[model samples]
Target: MISKYQQLRAQALPHNRATLMALLKKHGIQSLSVFYSGSGSTGDTDKITATPPEAVARLADVTVSLHQAKVEVLAGVAAHALIAEKKPALEALREFTLAWVEQTHCCWANRDGGSGDVTFNVAQDTCRLKHTEYYTGSLHHEYSL
Candidate 1:
C-alpha cells in the first residue's frame, strides 16, 4: 500500500512552484536566496537585478510545502525511482526527513497567516535536487491551519 506521504506528494505535485511563490509573496518575502562575495583589494560598486525570463522560469520550478498541514511536495519527480536501491544514505535521509516533517507539521501555528511551505528534492547522480517554500497569508488560517 502507498504511504500517506506518497499520496499527499501526488496531490501536491501539480502546484508546487506556483504554490511556493504565492506563499512567499504573501509573507513579504523578496528573495528566495541571497549571496555575498568579497574582493581582494578595492572593488567597484556592482548592481544586481532579476531578469524577467529567468524570474518566470525560476518561479515555474519551485518546491511547495504546507507547514500547517504537515505536507510537502515536489512537482514532476519520480519518488519510487529515487529509492529503487534503498541506499543507506537515502534511507537515512528519508527517515530524518519524515521525522522532521512530522514535527514541523504537527507544531505549525500559522493558521490565520495563510502561511505554508514546500520543498522538492530532485534526484541526481552526484547530488539530489532540493527546493523549499514558505508562504503567509489569510487563507492559511481559514483552511489548512
Candidate 2:
C-alpha cells in the first residue's frame, strides 16, 4: 500500500526535479550539488548548505558576486526560494534532497538524524543521492513495584 510520503514523493519528485532543472538551465548552471543535514528529535533543524557557500550568497544578491546570480521564485516573495525557503528553507534544493532521503532512506531521516549530499549533473542528466543514517537507540527498563 502507498503511504502519504510515498504519494507525496510520487507527485513531488518529478515536479521538484523539473523545477530544479529549469532553474539550472535558466542560470546556465551545468552542474550543482546541494548538501543537506538534519538532526533533531522532531526534525527541528534541517538545512541546505551552500555547496561553495558563495553559490547561495550570490543568489541572495546578484550584486554581491559576479559569479553568483539570483533567481527569483516569486516577484514579491524572497529570492532565495530558488534554493531555499524562508520559514523552514526546505523547498527547491532543500526539498529535493531532504524529501528524497526521507522517502527512500528513512521517513524519519531528519527526525532521527541523517546527513547527505545530492549531486546533479545536468549535462549527463543524472543525480546521485548519498546519505548515512545516524544511530538511534533507546532503553526500556521496567520493574514491578
Candidate 3:
C-alpha cells in the first residue's frame, strides 16, 4: 500500500517544483545545500554552483507525512512579513525545502496536516495548515529534538 506521504508527494510534487523554481529565480540563489535534520556539515556551503535546477534535482529527498488537507509556508506569518498573497511565500518555502532536501532525507512534516503546514492550490492561494500536537500547554514554549 502507498503511504500517505507518498500519495501527497505524487499530488504536490509537480506544483511544488514549479513554485520552487520561481523562488530560486527570485532569490538569485546559484547554489543550495543544507545541514538537514540529522546530519553534519563539512562547512563547505559557500561555493556558487551556477546551476540550481540541476543541482536541486540532484539534491536529497525528504519523506514528510501530511494527513490534513492543507499546508502553507510559515516564514511570512512567522516573521510578520507583509504578504499580499500566500502563494509566493509558499513557493519560497518550497525552494528552501528543496535546498534542504538536496542535503538530506525526509523533511518530517506533520501528519495531521495543521494550518501552518505547506499547501498549494491550483486556482487559489496556498493554504496554511495548523499544528496541534506536541504541545506542552505553554503559549510560547520552544522545543527541539
Candidate 4:
C-alpha cells in the first residue's frame, strides 16, 4: 500500500534531472535534494536520491539542519534512483537554486534607490538575500523581515 507521496516520488524516478527540476518549479517547491548512495563492486550499484526540500527547511541554524539527522532520511536513499544524466541532478539543483535566488530581490521603491545582493551556495543548500540598509551608504542588512 503505497502512500500518495510515495507514488508521486515513484513517478519522478524515471525522469531525468531536467524533468525533476521542471516539476519542482511547476509545483512551486522551494527546495529539493539529490544525494548518492552505495560504493559496491557492481560499479553500477551507486544510486542517487531526491527529497522534498521543506523536509529540511525549518528552524535551521547557519551550520546545519536537525531534520537531516532523522533515520528515515537515511533509509530508502537508494531504493529509488533517477535516470542518469550527463549532468547530475545536483547540477540541475544548482541552476534552479541560482535562478530561484535571482528572483528574490526587492529594490524598486527605495527612497534611496537601495539595492541588494544574493549569496547562494548550492552545495550547502543555503540562500541569503542581503539588502542595503535604508538610507545608509550601501550597508547591507540581514534578517528576513
Candidate 5:
C-alpha cells in the first residue's frame, strides 16, 4: 500500500509542474532557477533568475520555484489531518506557489540548517529540485576546580 505522503506527492507533482509551466509561459521565460541557502544562527536567503532576466521582473509580486511549491503543497496536505481533506492538492499548491516565491525572513537554524536549488526548463518541460540539510551536533565541556 502506498503511504499518505506518497499519495499526496503523486497528486501534487503534476499540479505543481503545471503551475510553474504556466508561470513561465505567462512571463515569457524560457528557463528559471532559484537558489536557496541557510545556516545555523544565520538565516535563509533565496534568489530567482530567468533566461531573460527581464522576464523575472515581469513576474511582479508572486513567483516561486518548484521546490517551494512542492514543500507548501505537502505541508498543506499534512495540515489538513485527513486524507478526505476539502482542499485538493492542485488548488492548494497553486494557491501557495502564487502567493510567495520566497520567505521574507526565516531562520533555518530553528530547524537545523538546509540549502537547495531548483530549476525549471520550459523548453525541456523539466523541473529539478535539489536540497541538502545540515544536522547539529552537541558539544561536551568539563570544568576543573
Candidate 6:
C-alpha cells in the first residue's frame, strides 16, 4: 500500500508539481507513486499494462502505479504560505487539505468510469470510493481495497 502522503502528492501533479514538491520538501515526504484504477471494455479485460513512464520522469520522490485499483498515502496537508508565515501546524494542515482536494481532482483521471462516487474526507484524511458510475459498487469495493 502506498502512503497517504505520497498518493496525495502524486494526485496533485495535475494541479501544481512545484506546490507538491515544496509541500513534500517541508514535511520530508520522500516516497511517491501515481496509481490508476479502472476496468476494461469487457468484464474480464484489462486496459492499462504499464505506468506512464513519462509522468514522473522529472518529479522527485514520486513513482507511477498503473492499472491498480487503489492507492493510499499518509500525509498532512499544509499551506505553503502559512508555513512561510509561521502559522500553527494544525491550521496549515486544515487549510491545505481542503485546498488540495478542491483545486486538484485526483479522481478526475478515472472519469470514463465516473467519479466513482469519490469522496474526500478531511476529518479522516482519506479519499473514499463507494462505486463507479459505469459498474456496480461491489466492483469498486473490491478495487478500493
TM-score of each: 0.21, 0.57, 0.30, 0.22, 0.52, 0.21
Could you give me the TM-score of model 5 versus the true structure? 0.52
| Candidate 5 lDDT, 11-127, residue by residue in tens | 655656686688777767898777666665543336677898887667665535442212235745634221322343324333333222222123443467677666788888887
**Which residue pairs does candidate 4 place in steric collision?**
none
Top TM-score prediction, candidate number? 2
Q: Count the backbone clashes (under 3 Å) in each candidate.
A: 10, 0, 17, 0, 0, 9
Instruction: Sort all candidates by TM-score, best to worst.
Output: 2, 5, 3, 4, 1, 6
Residue 48 miss distance in model 5 (angstroms): 0.7
Worst 10 residues of 3 by lDDT: 39-48
lDDT of 4 by residue, 1-145 (tens): 8544445444443232345434345444454443221122111111222244453333122121111111233554533332333333344444333333223322232343333333333344454544443353566778985
In model 2, where is the ten-residue run with the lowest total lDDT?
61-70
**Model 2: runs farther than 4 Å from truth?**
42-58, 61-90, 110-112, 136-145
Superposed Cα deviation of residue 58, candidate 2 (Å): 5.1
State the number of backbone clashes in model 5: 0
The 10-residue segment with the lowest total lDDT in model 5: 97-106
Candidate 6 lDDT, 1-145, residue by residue in tens: 7655455555543333344334434444343322223434211111111123332233344332211113333476442211123333323333333334333444432434422232323223344334334544443334553
Q: Evaluate model 1: give its lDDT.
A: 0.32
- Stretches > 4 Å off in candidate 3: 3-5, 39-145
lDDT of 3 at 91: 33
Model 6: how far residue 71 lies from native, Å: 30
The better candidate by TM-score, 4 or 6, is: 4
TM-score-better candidate, 4 vs 5 = 5
Model 5: which residue pairs collide?
none
